[model samples]
Target: MNLKKIILSRTDAIGDVILTLPLTAYLKKVFPETEIIFLGKDYTKDIIENCPFVDSFISWDAIEKNAVSEFQKINADAILHIFPKSQIAKAASKAGIPIRVGTSHRAYHWNTCNRIISFSRKRSDMHEAQLNFQLLKGLDINYIPELEEFKDINLIEPKQELREDLKEILNNGKFNLILHPGSKGSAREWGVDRFAELIKLLPKSKIQIFITGTKKEGLLFRKDLVVPFPDVVDLTGLLSLKDLMLFIKNCDGIVAESTGPLHIGSVLGIHAIGIYPPIRPMHPGRWAPIGKKTKVFVKEKKCSDCRKSGRCKCMREIASIEVADYITAL
Candidate 1:
């Protein structure tokens, strides 16, 4: 029970990593002296580093290259497989880190992990953040946090300063809103046309809009969304992850599907609005942003038709005007 150092392993995308941060806050509450080391992928390094709860970050790539040796170097008292990887589970066991926590569902965890918790993410109705708390049962920590408790966690604090050019782009008078139209094909998109419509609805004098995405996503929607709206700033492919975090911190709000920036905006205490489809597991009920100023837009009904398709008609059906109205109200 007197654990000094623990590794919270969630080598996943930005949003997933962001969701896992609240668990660190709770862990710190229980064991204030415990050194929290985050195990994440190279791309999500910035997200993990920004977390005030995490003491250090160890790249999953390093562990994958030399699992046992790398894990042994840390000398962690416990390792939680937040995102179960067979390689990590095996290595943690080999390294003899004492407590190894993972879900019982994964067949490999049975052999490698000593502390296995019974829970199914797909079947459970808990929010993604809440679901992560189930892993704590492995450590004999039974307290489950309510959703409201997450608001004051201060999960992500942007340490990076914005560049001169990026800093200048922020409109002090207007509501500086960011429109992230792509999810890297991770979630059901609200489509470029709807985003364009939303942009058009918001008055230029009142809302300074910025479009963010990868180079490929920008290229895909450039002619249709960017060129047509000359007033909107095209920051796609320009800002790095750290830069984006800094920029979001300065901005007033952000609107996107279930993606990294949306979660980042929420954690920063900005007006983070998420558009979601009413599909099982993917619905807002499961993956909504946990923030003081977060809002979700989704059709209040069950949807199974677009469960497999990324281009969800149900998501698109949530009118652009409705989103615009909500933003203006905020």
Candidate 2:
């Protein structure tokens, strides 16, 4: 099928959107003439803006209001429904996009999409990013990249102003280690109490630790604090998404539970240490960060259905001292 323009729809959260970028870059490399348009939530626009492969980014919200009109304006050759939104599938089909692509298992795609590829994420051994590449099967693009090569799909350097600000944050001559203790409910957390204890365990002189999360998370931690929270720098409420990327860019490493920051750190080629449980989809095998200097810390054996029980022994079993030692060694 000859293609000139295509829409790559992934209206998902930050990490999911970030994972989709490598496929975007790879497609651009293979089909240099195909204009790649990304469909995502308005909040994730910052992440797409940084992706050099994406020719344009259209908010899914904007398109939902008037699908046919919007799709006509986009006028793409095809639509790759990576995230499987039923409304989007119907819209693209109604728009008469010549080659509508999606997975066969979605069921909705059977009616809404003309070009469907067989895929099942549950039984697959591939990482989430690599799994997104499977949609290329419909286009007869059959290669899925190795995990290490995902780093090459990184964004252009952080903005110049962000770089200048980072210099000051790192002026203390200590290794900057970003400690992200919140996961925004996207994945199982490594516990804030555990993070505080780990901070106290790390060497004071060698590493400058920074605690990061959203303002709501900061307020929750503050209210929950029994003793004063540790002596690390707290930057929970302030940074924009772009600012956070720059901050992670300059830092020596990041220790985060399975979350957006961990993925960002990985793509930037920084030391991205992901703290994961042995949980199924959340396990390191499925969600671990990919970078030159990335590592995942998880306990042995399956972390079976712990979120429902309210007590996860395996995740809590990982010691603060062990994590501190790992960070300091890096």
Candidate 3:
């Protein structure tokens, strides 16, 4: 298959978008001159805007009818549909791109693409990053040694005046710890009482808490949270995606559940304690961040509800002291 222009469609949630970056980077590493375009959600533009590997990024929302009109100006050689069931794929197919590659898994609403690579496994089989990369084998780019892990940063800098304003807000402030108690992965959260207890455990005199989330999670935080400290900075529903990333970069560390921010922190090399439920899988080596600074807290239990979304009895048994001890070690 002679692929000159390529499009990777991964217009899903944040973690799925982040996990697919390795494929884009690998495509660039193998075929540096090839024009690589990424199709993702509108909000994720910043996540990949600075990726040197990607030639251009097109918002999936822009495909009103099909990808032909939007990508026609760009002149792509082929399209690689990561989440193939997306309407964007139909648009790309309608656009008359010669070659299209995607996963062969028939579980989800699998669409008809020209070339489908079969990497079907159980849901618990492989990391999403690896599965996405396997789709590239049709282009003779199949080697998937672990990609070089690095902090993901965009080049978008605030104006000089805005920078000064941020500096003023941070002046004379104690070290801030991002306490992200919000997650979309299943409803088995540690609850607000646990978060309040965690705050009470921290020495509030030396540290501050920034409760962060989007508009949905902001509502969740308010509904369940009982703040034990006065220094809590509830910035939920306030910061944009890039703003949240910047805020996380400045913080000392993050203590969060299995959320997007946790993965963001992992990508940034920030020390994070991922409060994983006991029922979840245990191999951080394959799934979570690979660096030494990241620590995962998953309690082992006899009967785990590991159906990817069931209630996990193991996570409920985890204690705050163990988490605090892990933080102290970090």
Candidate 4:
């Protein structure tokens, strides 16, 4: 591989961005000296900073404003469109990025991308990370590595100062559990009532519970979950994304609906139990957390209610006691 500097563009949600990191990891294994540039939204900067393989981060907004100059500044040898956006594709084309890779199914890619791979992500049985690797077919990487290979990718450790502050709420012998009740409308929630019930089911003496989410989500959950537990800590609105990333590293486990924090917890090697609905694309098979201690709770068969109603109780059906039992045992 003659590639020196390559840009992997994925300007999407947090979970999708997490799944795309393995691509950079795999490339670094094959081409150790290559510079990896991640072109993504401004909000995902912290995630880019955490990756050792990534040499730099280019904001999508900057690319949109001045694609030629941005590409000129870095002199990227290749560009991979993991999450296809017409503007980025066109910009890469205009900048004359030598080895522009994109999916053949996307009509715009034919005109913009120099190299294209024929693959369908929706119908494939592969995990999202594996499917993302398929876009590398143009580079003669024909096979997708297993889920375990992706899990082996390195992640940043928790900051020392962040751990010291968390010591106040974390018990010495108890399991530190972070319970996130909302999904920020990213995915269908498992319901706040279910999360509250799960909290009650856990042994307070053996478990330290902490609730985390945006301020708005905290307000939504405040009515039912306001009453304090013996060891439950409410940290919904206080922590920043950077702090949350470090905080997850200090915890023993995390229980949340399919969300960004769940992915972060799993990547950080914490026991992450992701509650998900059995819907296509959103199912565990596609987007489950990739880690040694990851577990998913999704309905077994086709969800009858959600298929018709567009709202799922399938995830809610996963009993709180069952999740609580597993977390305590962890």
Each prediction's TM-score against the native? Answer: 0.98, 0.94, 0.84, 0.95
Predictions in order: lDDT: 0.93, 0.83, 0.66, 0.85
Worst 10 residues of 4 by lDDT: 155-164
Candidate 4 residue-wise lDDT at 198: 89
Best of the candidates, TM-score: 1
Question: All predictions: root-mean-square deviation over Cα?
Answer: 0.8, 2.0, 3.6, 1.7
Error of 3 at 10 (Å): 0.6
Candidate 1 colliding pairs: none
Q: Tens digits of per-residue lDDT for model 1 on 1-330?
A: 999999999998999999999999989888999999999999999989989899999998866979899999999999999999999999999999999999999999999999999999998899999999998998988877899999988998867788999989899999999999999878889998999999989988899999999999999998878899889999999988999999999999999999999999999999999999989889998899999999999999987888655568899799999999999987
Candidate 3, which ten residues in sequence have the lowest lDDT sum? 153-162
- Provide the lDDT at 126 for model 3: 60
Model 3 Cα lDDT, one tens digit per residue, 132-226:
77777757676655434433332223221223444445524565678788776532566666777677677666666678877787776665453
Whose lDDT is higher: candidate 2's or candidate 4's?
Answer: 4
Segments of candidate 1 deviating more than 4 angstroms: none
Q: After superposition, how far is residue 14 of candidate 3 from its true place, in Å?
A: 0.9
Instruction: Decide which is better by TM-score, 1 or 2.
Output: 1
Quote model 2's TM-score.
0.94
Off by over 4 Å in 4: 158-160, 228-230
lDDT score for candidate 2 against the true structure: 0.83
What does candidate 2's lDDT look like per residue over 113-198, in tens digits?
98899988877888998999999987888888898787655653454356565567673578888988888788887787888788
lDDT of 3: 0.66
